[model samples]
Target: DMNDIPPVFTTVPRPITLDDDVPIGTTVINLVAQDSDGTSPNNQ
Candidate 1:
């Protein structure tokens, strides 16, 4: 059966604190999302 399952956030970023002199372009955290459908386009 083909079912459309919505993507879920497998990894969620936690609250972060930045200093006043933080860089303009800085990566705070990384997030991960997964789809249960396990198919192209939808999975991605």
Candidate 2:
């Protein structure tokens, strides 16, 4: 049996404009990913 499963992203990421003087710790985007295999931790 194989324990390896690929991850999937249900939500699509949006594009945003950023300033050239943006801070170092600034967050551009937050992507949401999911796993089809419910048995794997990636789904959590």
Indicate which candidate wins on lDDT. Answer: 1
RMSD of each: 2.9, 3.0
Candidate 2 weakest lDDT stretch, 10 residues: 35-44
Residues 1-44 of candidate 1 have per-residue lDDT tens digits of 24588878988768988899989888878899777886676666
lDDT by residue for model 2 over 1-44, one digit each (tens)? 24456666777877799999999999888888765665645455
Error of 2 at 7 (Å): 1.6
Local distance difference test values of all predictions, in order: 0.78, 0.71
For model 2, which pairs clash? none
Q: Assess candidate 2 and give its TM-score to the true structure.
A: 0.54
